[model samples]
Target: MSQARPDHLTWRHRLVALAMGLSLLVLVVRMVELQVVNHERYIEQAADTRASGAATLTAPRGAILDATGYPLAISIDTWDIYIDRYVWAQDPDAASGAAIALAGMLGLDADQLMASGTSDDRGDILVQRRLPYERGAAIEEADLWGIRSLPSSIRSYPEGDLAGPLIGYVGLDNEGLWGVESDFDHLLRGQPGWVLHERDAVGRPIAFGQHAERAPEPGGEVQLTIDRFIQDIVERHLREALLEYQSSSGSILVMDPYTGAILAMASMPAVDLSAVGTDGAPEGEALAGSVRNRALTDLYEPGSVFKTITTAAALDLGLVNAESGYEDTGVAEVGGYAIRNWDFQAYGWVTVREYLQRSLNTGSVWLSQLIGAENFYDYVERFGFGEPTHIGLSGEAEGMIRTPEDQDWYPVDLATNSYGQGMAATPLQVLTAINSFANGGLLMRPYIVSRVVTNDEVRSYEPVEVRRVVSPATARTMANLMRDVVEGVEWHGARVDGYTVAGKTGTTIVSIPTGYDFDTTIASFAGFLPYERPAVSVLVKIDQPGGDVNLGGQVAAPVFAGVAADIMEYLDIPPSEQLVAGQ
Candidate 1:
């Protein structure tokens, strides 16, 4: 107005000033919002852009130790190799040369490596997994482009094939798969950790860059009740017998009868656990019977091992005493089915104790009638048959028993079941049931793991009594009767030199689809040593042994003797005064 400028020029000047003021105001508002109101959001975004990579730290699996603290299964640090496809794509000639060189070092095919490293779609590709220290070190020395390695672990068994099936195995994902591994997987597998590191714009980790990491927690250790020394002895003798008998297969279990702690358990035709991979199959051995622990899973007629259960039931019910006399016509008829003893010969009149010593079928049938079918079934159930032991192992089977409530139950069922026929039981079940006598009529829950050592504390497992099957007096009387069996002339093969062993021998015809196969039989023996104290219980079983020497006394009893003799000497058990004086 002072200069008297034109009206259009004045309007243009005013408009320019207004636009400048608006721009300043907007800039100030934006600065305040970014620096104060939205400060945390922006900062987080910036940090996200700076963090280029993350890595996982695998935790070491716990060691499986024996009672003496010897490691059965352990994890060793290793390396895993990887290839960056984007880096290799930069140069064709260099990529080809690197692929060939890597293949030669890793014993891999050249074409496979080239294909793996030349993929533009995939960022990082696996070149190899779980390589040993020496092999990984050799590859690292090459230091080729696009090649890298990280730390890892591989499972190893120091004592190969010893407790192989029981210790179980791990999978490629560093997870437990079978046996104790599968049973206590959460306790054995430790917590995994992770790391976040800053990287430059080129996707390479910046030198001295900011990083954050969480340290991994190693898994707790597992202490088993297995005794390596005793296990070794059992395996040695079992292997010899397996080959000598020319039998289909066999198994032996040595347990602390009072505690139900398995000291040594061996299965013949064993799979080399060290040779097995993450796939859970053995490479060299036949896979049919190798993978499964037959003692827990397989069921057979049990033959004479079932007789002890019947004897204990009779004595507990007061249906028969050791001195009770019965007339044996060599055969007993039930439901029109004529059953005879193993010898198929009549001994005329014999005491009830002679029934167990001689393993008489007619005498057991007669006793079963005196106890009645209903009472007989109740006694069998009390002995823990027809159910799984819940031994913390997978694939445990419950044996079959026909009771009075079942539609198929008949009078003949009573006679056959009394003598261990027409019903099925697993080796574990037979062993556990017979163990009641040794445990002072107390049935205990069997367990393999004895202790667990964690970073925080250590826990020791105690013997758990499940139930009492008989009175203490009755148990003592039954023990005495079994002692006579071991001392009898027919069972002289089973007698230990210094120990008053009490056991029963069984030989029964194999049942087939058509009927009992008279030519084939399963031989078995169950006994406990140091008769007075009863430190250990042993069960030896041979399946389908060829030739005429297939009797339990001939094939299975000697194994019991050999194993017991070694165990007594190793344990430093003193011989009885009776034994010393006799010697």
Candidate 2:
């Protein structure tokens, strides 16, 4: 009645009011969905915008030390530099200029770096790895846009290639790839840590951004039994001998017979640790062959070295004495095959002492026949043949020995094997077997790693005695016989001045797929010095020696004398006369 509005205007006002109410209801429902149902999802999306990520912090690898705690291989702190591709892509001109500056400082290609930054699908592009700490710090301080650096490390060999094959090398990712590095990788590569933090637009850590981090734990130190001085001595002599003999390759191993601790093991041709995987490094088959630690990996006929085991078994069983005599017509017919002395000279009758000194193949077969096939093979197994030495190195060969039980076994096989043919053994196996005589007939398990030092504790590896192969009386008698072999002869090549040497020489015709090579031979000597109080047992093997002088006494025994003399002097072990006088 006060203002009787038109009916049309009142209805229009009601519709407008309803539409406003519906719009208000829709706004409330949308707010509830975003704040409640999708709350965590939106938060994560927002985090993505702030460039939040967990950065890996690489832990430093451990050091490999020698017997006297000298570092052979180690890792030093460095830095890995990267460019934020996303940030670089946003500004091409700025990326180019920054790349040029970095390239100038780091000796990199400027154009290539820029191209990689822009075209790489990854958000972070690796510009450089293993930059020296000082250089990396300088780069970081410069704060160049789109560039970042993270702490890293690189494997370093202070002694260079001194023990390269044994110490091994690492890959670009800071992981051990060979030798002790590969064998003890778990202990060498410590646990890595990480940091969760927000980054700025250019992928740099934001000063005030939320952050959390866990410190990295460094790896434990590996202590090897190898003596650096002894290693150097062995390597020096071995190289000289290889060159003199014109040998294709060789191995020299020195061990502590009592403890079976490896003092020095050198195998040529050696791989240079620092130069491995570089521009001029060996590749494919050559690389594979170069990296091998041949002392334990390569197998060959033990030759007359196997005679030592046969004689020991016969003496232990009382089947033969040092004075036991055998008739030698220069050759013995066994199983329709003729076995002859190394010199192929007929000695109508020879004592056991002469058998070893002369290295007569017929004499070895005579002893084997007396010992019987079962007893001979038993001695072989007891001496740790046909098995690996388990010296804690990779690629060790388990040697091959066929017995009467095998289908290929024949009576002739026994005759040949008695003189170290029709069988195979590694240089390590030959040494360890001969080492039994020096250790009073006790077989000891050889080991390379002496100890491991960690932040929490120090673990030392003790000497392990596997078994006794003969009586101490038998061992003494054998030692005496071996001593006679060296000293009994006038001007013996194996004789060391002022030291009583006990040893055996071995020379084998190189076997091929068709048969033995008439032109090549493997010359070797296995021996120990100061026989009454043995300190070191050594094995020297020279493969495929050139020229006509390839006999063990001519080529290998002289090298042994030189090496043993130097080692005795270095260890301050008194001469044989002094030792005997003290006793």
Candidate 3:
């Protein structure tokens, strides 16, 4: 042993030997794992690990624009504020100040800000979400430790509640939640561009800038048929009616009858699109109770506006001539059920045209019986009842009609349906049904968007015709009669000067505690303008207008009138009837 000690190995030599042995052992184990034990698992893990450094692609969501290229909704650069609670805990006093200051800068409630204290379960707490650039900058200047700002985009509506339901807002994840925003999501959500970058073991950006970058793909733009000026006019009149009649809520819409392009769509008590949170309970009295698009989604009895379709159908089937006379006894009995006039006044020996003008229920029941139930049903389906126009918009309802096979088909159903009672349909459906008169008896698909544009190209959509429900002559005759209604009779209040106004009033009985036969009611109006040119159509609906006992003429007709007046003047349409006729 003493002789061997004379030739002892150096520390460097020993270290080399130990390192070689450990390397050999590691190689053997790795070889066994890769070749036999878990080869496939390792391979899959390797494949998945490649995504560790993969970049996230951001697709630019398309904007919604008005006829004048004003943005109803747009994506703007914003930031989200967060904090590492553990890091924040290292300095509690400073950390609490940072959170409070962030809340103040972002206009957050003090209690909500206090909830993100050091003891929060999330190691990292989100201090603020979707902070505007100025607010984010202000927070950054505060120089708070452990706080971070992440880049993002927000959907902003510049005009606030204008066309609120028609042009809906989006969520933080770039998903469309409602209305047009949800309808055209795929079209609005463009292909996302990405960055393929190299990251370290901890998934941090590499210092060498070793990455491949691709520019973001912005979504295509959507241009709607909505006219902002007309929309404003309609909103004003709707509000006026709400005040005068003390209604619960209301909606207004304008469309092109031939093309079926919606020009203006509005609902009262509209929520603020710019607000970060809309789903939660309202904080103030100014908040609107229901801002959903009532025109396209809410279903109700269409009243006399629906009468136009029935009258047209009867005339088209040759069951009744416009000059034909009906004996009106104030009430008509169907299956032993009596249907009376709204005012309980009899229209004795009234002509078909006069019945429509008076919106007499007895006359409509007579027309339905004369046309026959089977034939009347055929006309209703032909008029697009119980079916969505398939305008490619989200949340559109097909409405309700008792089919021949469906249950609850009482004889009274047919009788009451003749005068637009005991059946439900959306406003858009009603408008499209009315358009049968404007499109030469051919129905056009009701749609809101007129065009889609991209940086590379612009695409336009024309009016797509569905089918001919009646003869062109019948449509013309009906249009002429509708013109007479707005330009001459009870609905004369709905007329616009220098334009031929054609429309019908609807005072549907509410379906609440008191139903179709009860005293509670919803007031509404549906019409089309410039009867000759047939460029635009309008519909206005007011829910539960409790005062004045006004039908559609008092509450909704004025809205239709204001919108038509503004649009006709803007288009410079020649007066189809004199200004005196409207008055």
**Which model scores highest in lDDT?**
2
Model 3 TM-score, all chains together? 0.78
Q: Estimate candidate 2's alpha-carbon lDDT, on a 0 to 1 scale.
A: 0.88
* lDDT (Cα) of model 1: 0.82
Off by over 4 Å in 1: 1-56, 90-116, 119-122, 134-145, 195-213, 277-288, 578-583
Q: TM-scores, in order shown? A: 0.83, 0.87, 0.78
Q: In candidate 3, what residue range of length 10 has the lowest lDDT sum?
A: 281-290
User: What is the total number of backbone clashes in candidate 2?
Assistant: 0
Rank by TM-score, descending?
Answer: 2, 1, 3
Over 55-115, each residue of candidate 2 has an lDDT whose tens digit, in order, gives: 5678999999999999998999998899887668777888888899888889999999888
Q: Which has the higher lDDT value, candidate number 1 or candidate number 2? A: 2
Ranking by lDDT: 2, 1, 3
Q: Candidate 3 on 317-406: residue-level lDDT in tens? A: 887777898889999888888889988999689987888788888888888888887888999999899998897777778898885566
Winner on lDDT (1 vs 3): 1
- Evaluate residue 30 in candidate 2 and report its C-alpha lDDT on the 0 to 100 scale: 90
